[model samples]
Target chain A: MRVENYSFVFAVFFANVFAWNPTPQVIEEQVPQTAFAQLLDFQNAARPEYNAYLSAGIIYLPLPSQSALLTEWGTHNGFAFRQRIGIWLTDNFDGKGSKGITFGLGWFGERQGWDNEDFLFVPNRGNFSQINQIHSWGLTIADSSKHWLFGGGLQYLNAKDESFRWWLLGTWSRFSIMPNFHKGDLQFINAQLFLQARELLGNENSWQNYLPDLEFSFYTKDSVKIFVSQNIFKQKYYLEGAFWARPQDFAYAALKFYPDPSRLLLALEATATKKDNDDIYFGGGITLPFLRVAYNHADDYESFFKSRGIWIVEIRLAIGSSGDSFFALKAPKAAPKEVKRIPMKKANFNSNNGE
Target chain B: MKSVKFLFLLLLGAFFSSCTHWLIDTETRIQVKNSTNRDIYELSVISPGKRIVLVPDTLKVDESSNVHVISWVGKFKFAIFVKNLPDSVYLGEYELKGGSIKAEIKGEDMALKMVLK
Candidate 1:
């Protein structure tokens, strides 16, 4: 039954993306990004300045951990989505940051038309499921405030197993605490939330907007990523790097060009695979206000990653209750106008209506 | 004459030592014991952030917070922020060789007595 609902969501998502509509991207402000949900909603992972956000995309890679591949069940390639919202107890404290708790919801699993690839590449998997029905959903919670942010997230799947990650960060330092970063770059406190959060939301819409005064960044599930981002060449481009001492970590040095801070972004990145030998994966992504498109490719289908290549499409949305509502990805609308008018009469009870 | 010369040298050394003590900063452990007429409402080891370590709960008179080891050179400042008293109190910069300082709160009027060892 759960899988059936998943199939329906997939259908609707495709229809919304591929089908033509009269609505244009300019009116996104009035529409509120989507009546749907997004990535941070912790993304305390949250660098965390938003009231809400939603991120969902399709990945071309399968789950590639020793445990994920050889455990009781092998995972499948499918669509991935992350959604989160901050229930602000006190919002935009001291004018820049907020105090709140963040709740997250997301899923990863089989796409309806896509073929089952769970056992196609595995060897000696006489016991593995050939039906290719692998799926996992995650729930996350974190304390999101200007002073501190921490998260504990768990993933549940059809297989009889669970993976849990605990994330904590102290935001006061305003820079990375760990030493393995490019000089003056920011560090990551929670990787799960911000690894993609920073990319999905961009610099202006980041949680940094809610910070009391300074900036910081993220790490990932297995490794840490240090980022140094600044607007250069008269604020036309942004550059950030993930520098690490160890070679077995996923690292990237990226540069992005944008005409406006929010409307469009083009990224050129040199991504590294965790495989021991020195090999770089180069890819780029193009971002619109609420949608992002990127291409993915493996290393000749022979290296640590499998399968040569595929394209990925993701939706990213972020909006906060405080600060400037105009930049909301469909942020909030302008405040209602005040009007004064003459008083009118009260209505009488109608026979057809029940009191 | 030799005894008189030694006494003069000793006096000169004493005066210079006291002057240097006033000039430099030092590191030491800090312990606060609530000895005031009223309990302590807030305690902080503030620097970049006004880190409030305690709240709502009272540090009643004669009860002390845990011993905080000050490992570096900075102002050993603190305060009690009750609603009626919005003003915070600061303990002046301290210089010590290699010991600890115990702050004894005497009253609600913010009379602080420091015992430096």
Candidate 2:
């Protein structure tokens, strides 16, 4: 069998054991019970005037060596599983100008699985039986007032194996100012910066560093948004444009045909130093009641564990205490006071009837 | 022969001494649903090392009313452990009634509605 095929089979076996079966149980047992549940409910509420959300996903990458066997004895080589969770704190979480200032925290863990003979980061190329595990955490803060949205965050990562240890510190910040333009078209200017530091905290001899990233996005209308970003230091640049329809639930069958609840996105990225390495990416996806799927060319497999590229598929299954209400593709518009007041009475009436 | 041996040693040393590491960012979303007949009055997310202190450890439910009101707030601290690092964690609240749930953090408002499954 080819290397990729063997990797797929091994991946399926481990995936069945690790990713699919254990997640449901873990989620069920870990569901919170208290004000936190209320916070989650609020975050998930449709038309959340202001809200925050926290989520986690895991990605797996199998090594090529795992596909080939030695002798007749079949030995399975392990793959890398990168796990990440993020808290999306957004003021005006509903996207309506109802609230401001939201904070989020994201934490991640990446484990590199390799056999004793294949371990790479060893002193004097020594053989190490243990695998390497890395841990990282990030925090994002956004403050959105009447006309402006500003946010920033940092990430710290530490990795260790039998032979060596490494550490990295990265920082990112973004500012977006929305200016009142002519009818229906909202114009905005955005700026972003990213910086990173790498060091061998344990051995001290092995170290490297990089600092690159900046970009801007312009929201022209409800259906059109354009952005350009570049890493001035690294001389790399990218342009991206996206078109999305107004949000509508499947229940509103007639309304669906009007806006076409789908998205088309195009992006091009190139390195000034080596423009030949440039890559162009195009993707389109749909939003449905049961699942959400999207395809993208630039796959962040290393960071997100998910694939990105020519043909990528993303499938999400909505399973939580709340049903379709939890995942809002876009913020909901504000409801008038009279409309808001009715639910309070309805809740009270339900309680009374139950009694 | 001596020069060839020296070149081989240099290549081996260079390969063993150099290392590279990649930094990645991941996002996870968690959804919680309430199926019980009773209104879920409160929700809290607790990490492995954190303590939850409820001013009143218990709730008093009115025997004749199905409404549940949780009116208490306490601080909890989460400590990072090498093995217990969680990718994402969240707590949510839902009013069994057909209204929106709201959480305000740093002045941002997030509203959600509860749907009966």
Model 1, runs deviating above 4 Å: A1-49, A59-160, A173-225, A247-250, A263-277, A297-308, A315-321, A324-355, B1-117
User: DockQ of each model against the real complex?
Assistant: 0.00, 0.01
Off by over 4 Å in 2: A1-50, A60-76, A89-153, A160-296, A300-355, B1-117
- Give a tens-digit lDDT track for model 1, residues A145-206: 44243333322222222222222223221321211122233223422212212322223445
Per-residue accuracy of model 2 over B25-86 as CA lDDT, tens digit each: 01112122333222222233233544332111111222121232321111222111111223
**Backbone clashes counted, model 1:** 18
Ten contiguous residues with the weakest lDDT in model 2 chain A: A249-258
Supply the DockQ value of model 2.
0.01
- Model 2 CAPRI quality: incorrect
Error of 2 at A220 (Å): 29
What TM-score results for chain B in every one of the models? 0.47, 0.19
Candidate that scores best on TM-score: 1
lDDT of 1 by residue, B32-76 (tens): 677666656565433334544422335676887665654332223
Clashes of each: 18, 42
Residue A71 of model 2: what lDDT? 15
